[model samples]
Target chain A: MIILIIIGMSLVTMIPRVIPAFVIEKMQFRPWVNRWLSAIPYAALGALIFPGILSVNPDKSQIGLLGGIVAVILAYIGLNVVLVVIGAIITVYFLSL
Target chain B: MTDKAEIYSSTAVHMIKRGFITGIPIMLGYLPVAITYGVLAKQAGMTLMELTLMSVMVFAGASQFMGVNMIAVGTGTLEIIIATFVLNFRHFIMSLSFMNQLRELKLKWKIPLSLGLTDESFAVSSINKDEAKMEKGAFFYGTIISIAYLSWIIGSFLGGVLGDVIPDRLSQSMGIALYAMFIGLLIPSIKKEKKIAVIALFAMLIHALCIQLGMSTGWAIVAGTIIGGMSGIYLLKEDVA
Candidate 1:
């Protein structure tokens, strides 16, 4: 069962990725669809990042927000992803102290 | 061999080598996180072999973490399968976009490329695609993904061996880094386009509201993305135009 579940997981993840490249190589999405697709990067990033921020238990009120803000600032200046994350973690740690 | 053929082969080889080296930083980032995943799976009563196989087969961080939870609670296999499938459904969108970008690449490359299409790898691969005049070929992406794959496997082994070496405080704090990484990814695009900021803000608001109202994470994200993207089509169109 475990192995089957693993295989099933692999199929679901892989099929979506695999089918498009091979099967739909010549197809182009409609303009509206393309618009929606372009919006995906931002929308998806926002959804993933925002709620998780609030869920982190706060020491002071909404303390994690500071980390989020710091991360955004660091990232904006073209800092590497690793550094951006480390900066946010360090900021939050200091705020906790 | 003809000079043309030799040059082509060397370029391909060079791209692959460059890809592997570029992947090193992503490998570093993934190592600790995959190790964290390993630690979680271990806590959930996974045997070392089972955990190793799970990471190998799944190769997805969010799903693996959730799969460990489901397994720990003795959830049905279907539930585990369904939940992971749902969590990973966004891969459909990502793959579609990525595939279109690779019009120059061959159909045969799809298999391995798809398997390696994690969020981080996708981002890195796309950047390579954009920066080059020539196509970032199958072997280049394969090399990039393989480095990440190898690092993940090594990280899991270390985690299983170390067995919760991270202190409690540090562990909880590490959670913030995931959000931080997401923010880092978005900031570049947001800097490039004002419209993206609106979409991002709306998506965040909608997803948080959905979660507060007790919807599931996967569905909430899907809903938020759709709504936010739709809003962009209507609301930000004027600004963009």
Candidate 2:
């Protein structure tokens, strides 16, 4: 059943996550263990974000490609994220038109 | 003991503030996509109740979009589920990393929180070290999930109703919002590293390669994440270790 699969999948997903908490609840790890753990999140974040932007255009054409560049520039400068997304969308729309 | 309790209570407030601040990006990203997913799910022939159930239970943005697309194309239920799993595999890595921070939470809290974790929450929750490590499972999970859950419900409902009228180009363009939010999330952290430059470069390269290989959109994400992560670990392992 779909319900069972959802539960099963959810459990399978949570196991690697929740098991560590139970084991380490009362224990303290070395600072390095802590630091390495901290490093993983940012690293994972970089892995997740970079590809989404750069993967826009394979041929490096003007429309899709330029839109990605403009968005990245705005994003890099700490522009409002929502604005940057809209800017890219608008730019791409106009270009395609 | 009373002093410690007071401190914990104050820290809980701070954690909630931090969690709320982190949800801003999700708000920006979720609005358009969730709306589109709603519209698309409707277009794909899902009934109102079925669409709501998918949003409530799955709660994943991209996978849900892809799942509906698959269903639209007549993909079987089993295949749709498998595709979703593979696409969401990054959450597996995200959850494992958060496990260290979550070391103090009780099982009752952890079970529900972990189920609610998604790409957006994983990104938001993982960035704030203190929030990520909060042993007060109820507060931590409660704050993150509340924002995410509220946004999905509102966005999905709006999209389902209004999606038909929205233009095609606009719907396609909204895909960029989630990615843009991600860049905003990474700015503060990426500024901290020289090696991050290299890892990002490698991620782009791998992504480009994956596209060239004619892989599906979902598979490309998986490949790029694995390569990017390993590049970071290899580059930072010595310093971190």
Candidate 3:
């Protein structure tokens, strides 16, 4: 049963990812559609970070928020991406203590 | 002929090395999150094989986390698969945009490249300005994806092996690392084009609203991305079109 579940999950997950590469290159989208598609990465990044971060530590959401804030500051200061993540982790670690 | 061959191989090697260097940040970001996923999946009663296989096969962080959570609660197989699909639907959009961005590459490379199109790689690739100019652009991109993929597998395997040995507080804290990476990636873009900030804000608002209404996290992210992306049609300047 578990093996079946894993296989099913892999199929569904890979299908969406794999199909677009082969199909979309042949077609051309309208200008506005192109613009919308280009905007997706930014939007997805936003959606991925919020609400989910707060709930990272459901019992102490502040830890996550503070860590996010530190990340923003570090990134705004033009720190390296690895350093930004490490900075947030350190903040969360101390806060959780 | 020998000189040309030597030059070609050296360029490929250089691009591959550069790709590995560029992927270091993503590898760092994925490590903690992947480890956390491993630990939680173990606690959720997944055997080590099941836990590792899921990461190896799915290769998606958020969906994998959700899959394990759902499995732990004994969710039906169909439900888990559907949820995984919904959560991962963004990859479809990202893949299209990514392929379009790198349309100059050969079709053969694009197919394999799409398999590694996670959020982290997509962001890095999109932001990278020099890919088109490189002699082996597709290979460079492929190397970036390969390093991230390898790190995820290694981190998850390590997490499973070191599950109980690691303290609880540390693993919980590592949860913030991925979010931080996202912010780090998004901010530079936001700084360049203020309109991107609006798009991001719109996504955050919609995602929060969906969660407040008790929608699943997978659907919420999809809703937020689509709706937020739609807002760009109006808010984005004509220059972008």
Candidate 4:
């Protein structure tokens, strides 16, 4: 039963990825589809990053917001990636104290 | 001398080199996170071998951490598996892009390579403009798996042996590494277009609203994806028009 559940779950997980591969290999995408496909990754990344920036706590407080601001500001100015993160973490740590 | 054999050998070398270079940050970050995963797995009564295999076969970082945490908290297998599935859904989107670009490789190579595609590998590989497609794929995929495999091994070993000594404060600090990496990626994209800035701001607003409304993390991700994706499509259309 456990094996069957794993297999079932894997199939569901794998099919979404595999379908597009078959589609792309077999057919020429419409121009709009191509553009949309290109946008998917950047969009997906934005989705992931924003929430992380907003709340380190369940209450959605000011510290995470402030830290995010510092991080985004530094990131926009072409600061080092490691530095931007260090700055954000420091901002959060200090604000919490 | 067969040219194909030479190409294959060179590709292997490139893969290992790229793997090591791109994996440095991940190596730093993974030690803590993977160890956390291991400790939680052990606390949940998972044998060392079971923990190691999970790391080997399913090297996803966040999901594994959450899975073991859930197990430690006495969650059922069904819930643990479901949460893991939800967390890894992003890989489907990533894999599609990789597959389309990797038209040169056979399924044998592509299958395992696709499984190894993580955010770190995707970020590094997608940025490289000059490498040959198959070689880049091999390199990027190898880079991801090599670090991931090592982290899992070392993390589990450390957790199994020294689980009691690690401080919670240090374990929590690992989260900062991800934010730092994001800042790195964002800076370049921000320079490229005003539209990217707008999309990022828009996504952040939606994320804030989701948090304010008390949405769960999973739902927040869904909301952000929809808002960001729609805004990207809109912005691109405006630019073209």
Across B1-241, the per-residue lDDT of candidate 2 in tens digits comes to: 9999998898788767766765666776777778888888899887666666677767777777777787678876677667677677666656656655676666666665666777777776766555544455357556876788778978888887766656776756655566665665566556666676666567656766787799765566656656655665457755442
- Which regions of candidate 1 deviate over 4 angstroms? A56-61, B17-25, B124-133, B137-140, B231-241
Positional deviation of residue B217's Cα in model 2 after best superposition, in angstroms: 4.0
Most DockQ-accurate candidate: 3
Would you estimate the TM-scores of all the predictions?
A: 0.85, 0.77, 0.92, 0.77
Best model per TM-score: 3
For residues A23-64, write the lDDT of model 3, one tens digit per residue. Answer: 776888877887887788888898989988998789988888
DockQ for every model, please.
0.56, 0.33, 0.73, 0.36
Docking tier of model 1: it is medium
lDDT of 2 by residue, A28-77 (tens): 76665555555555555555665555444333355555676777787687
Give the alpha carbon lDDT tens digit for every residue of B1-241 in model 4. Answer: 6898898878788777865766665566567667777787788777777677666656666666676677667666687677767766667766665665564666655666666655555544443323435554666555665776687578876786677556665455445556556556655775776676676667667766887898766556556655665676657663331
For residues B42-95, write the lDDT of model 3, one tens digit per residue: 999988898899888989998898988999999999999998898888888888
Order the candidate numbers by DockQ, best to worst. Answer: 3, 1, 4, 2
Error of 2 at B223 (Å): 3.4
Candidate 4: CAPRI quality band? acceptable
Off by over 4 Å in 3: B237-241
Q: Which candidate gets the maximum lDDT versus the true structure?
A: 3
- Which has the better DockQ: candidate 2, or candidate 3? 3
Pairs with backbone N, CA or C atoms under 3 Å apart (clashes), candidate 4: B19-B143
**Each candidate: RMSD:** 3.3, 4.2, 2.1, 4.1
The per-residue C-alpha lDDT of model 4 at residue B239 equals: 33
